[model samples]
Target: MIFEKFGKKRESAPPHQATPTDDSVSISRRNFLKKTGLFISGAVVGEHESEKFLKKIFKVPSAEVSPKEAVKIMPHKEKHVSAHSPEALSEPSPEVSTETSKESSPLDAYSFLDGQIHPVAIPTGELAGNTFSDLYAMYLGMPNGTVVPETLHVDFKENLATLWRKKFNLPARSHDERVEREQLQFLEEHHNLMNLAEYVYRSYDAKSPNTMTLEEYRNDVVGAVEKSRKVFVDTLPLVPTSASEDGVFSKDKISLISKMGESLTADTLMSLSFTELMPLDKGSANAQVFGFLLRNAGVDFIDRIPSVYDMLESFGPYQITPDALSPKSAGSWATQVLSALPLGFMPWNVDELLRGKENIAAYTLAMLNIAQFIGTRNSAQLKCLSEVMHTLPSTQRAKAVLSFVAAAHHRPHEAYDAFDAFIWSMYVERAHSFREEDILRHIPTKDLREYTGKALANYRFLASGASVNNST
Candidate 1:
């Protein structure tokens, strides 16, 4: 799902500083929000269970929370946020236009971007899809094309590679070449989509406000659905047999979920959360969503949750501003966490990952990116790792948490930027809700820098397959 890079950085003004998307709005304040935090969730998504992530995180009767709340934030009128905001990240548009506009602009092309993954739309034949194109047709609840139930059976990896070849006009090849070239092409697209995701969040989600019009809403529906399938689907491994930790979701229910996953992106897989897919009541909507995500992202995706969370905590565009963060800050530490992924000790630069890597290097690089962190960490991210563990219930703790302190990247102060204004801090004075004891445990009351250093060194050596004697 890697898209070609746009020439200019599509900078959006933050709400306070926002200019009008149309003539109706005015803005007095804004910032560029240029932060270099890591991306938490690496793989593509937007499935029937999209809302389930939040539900699982905060178990309760489901509120009317939008499925992809992270993508479209309604306006919050605090000192930091303004009443007049862009639906871009969000402040709802001042007015609603139910009827289609008399004319349209280039932005109209992104109409498919409604970005929720509810209805199932499977592409057939030698067709196409992209983030800015038809990728989100199903999510917009305006699925197009002749979708047969059989499309559910296509091989996820092979189909993606097929789409890559057809898009580029690369000739069909023998088995050996298909194994080599198509695999390489798929990896390249994988890296490319990561870059584009960064760009999309940095430019649009970070700064510009978005509007929801009757016509524009229609397109956002389609465009967002397309974007998810094209972007995250590239990173998923093949789906495993869908089952809960205790195996609650039945085969028939799992099949329906598989169908939903496949329709969204021509595969069966599911992803997100720690411990428990949800209650097993076969008729429950929550149960169905859990089953759907399980089928769409595959079982191993369960372990990858923290790694993806690490990326969101560290690299998410809204989190860090290079200048505001000093060298000693946790933001720098989060950057190191990216270098220390358990996938291997390759220092991954997003630019290098997105370059002319149309060979094995692309696939290998993605392996490191896609591989789970296994709760690994250097001194830099140890507290953040512990926080992630704390975010989970003790009952939900599994071997995944036991593998903690291995390798991951993220900083606490910078990580909370999305919750507050970008004015986040290590002390977190504004976040009164976090328990004092919980925060105190991770914070080093007495210096244990030596143990911290050794822990990081040992883990890196172990993760990289270096011998104990190689440890510093």
Candidate 2:
């Protein structure tokens, strides 16, 4: 019964082909057979074993195999039959098989299995997902008609005060307090010159309006003269002479010089009839007398002179007694006094009153004046004007200079020329003496020009009724 069953199974199996020698078989084929579970114990069946099995089962001879055949077939062996039933291999359900087929088709399996496969998933719709552009726009987009806020401008003087505090080693106080303290110190030190100090203090005071019309300034001068006449008594002789060859003047002579000096304290020097101090002919006896008096007055007396001169200069416009004092003589005198004074006299100048101080009103007026000069292209005015700018801290200096440049560009020749030849000449003197490079060093020329252009455009836009926030 065993032989009959084996014979029947051998008849049902396919015919075996001749096998190639082990050496002639390729590594790929050997690997394929091993992977497919066709080999027993991971090794190829021996030709002898195959032949023996075939002969025993179907009575076939090994010599009958053709040399051209390469495939070798083995007869199936009956599995061990146990007394108990065997468990069947588990199979997927129909639905599970269908899902697995869809998930891993021949193409997918080939892609996964093949080394040279290039696969790409095809996009199915226009709006596949949020793209980078869409996401970027969503994050960055602003609503239509959104309004930007106007840029607030800081006062240049405040900027100057802040910068001054930062750059210089000063007392630990607010800028305003420091300024006031200095002004008070200046006043206290020169108590005799209270009137001139008061005038300067008022000019730089934040509470006072910084500007004055020519008429107003002249009227103040006249009032100052009357006030001085009331408060100061001129007791000394008009002319005093040296009593000795050493050039030491008598006490009465010194007293007279001191009284004449009082003219400065009273703010009456500007009001003095030019006849009283003029025609300063280099060779004249009167000029010689005046020169001697000034020389003998001592350094302390000369030190007080610059502040008085600065007060007179601050008036901006005034008339001189042409017969008594030529513009040339006035200029010469101013030059002489300026040269005689030390550099400390600089703070006494009207423009420098608020140095290391907080005086926005005065700073604004200065800006206005600088802007006017820029439009005029009056290098002389700009020259003198730049002095105040030079005194500012670096940041404030740049800002003030740029503001001047911008204002000039914005309103070129907008106003008629108000300064006369003498005034222009005087400014030319001061301007030529000023070191422009000192201030220009703070800002690049190109940046200044660009800033001017932008400022002009802004001014034009504002003039046209466009909002500054939207102008750019």
For each candidate, what TM-score against the reference? 0.22, 0.16
Q: Which stretches of candidate 1 lie above 4 Å from their native place? A: 1-145, 149-344, 347-392, 395-472
> What is each predicted model's overall lDDT from 0 to 1?
0.24, 0.24
lDDT by residue (207-256, candidate 2, tens digit) is: 12234322333244445444433222231122112111122234533333
Q: Mark the 10 consecutive residues where model 2 has the least summed lDDT.
A: 1-10
What TM-score does model 2 achieve against the real structure?
A: 0.16
Summed backbone clashes in each candidate are 53, 0
Q: Residue 152 lDDT in model 1?
A: 37
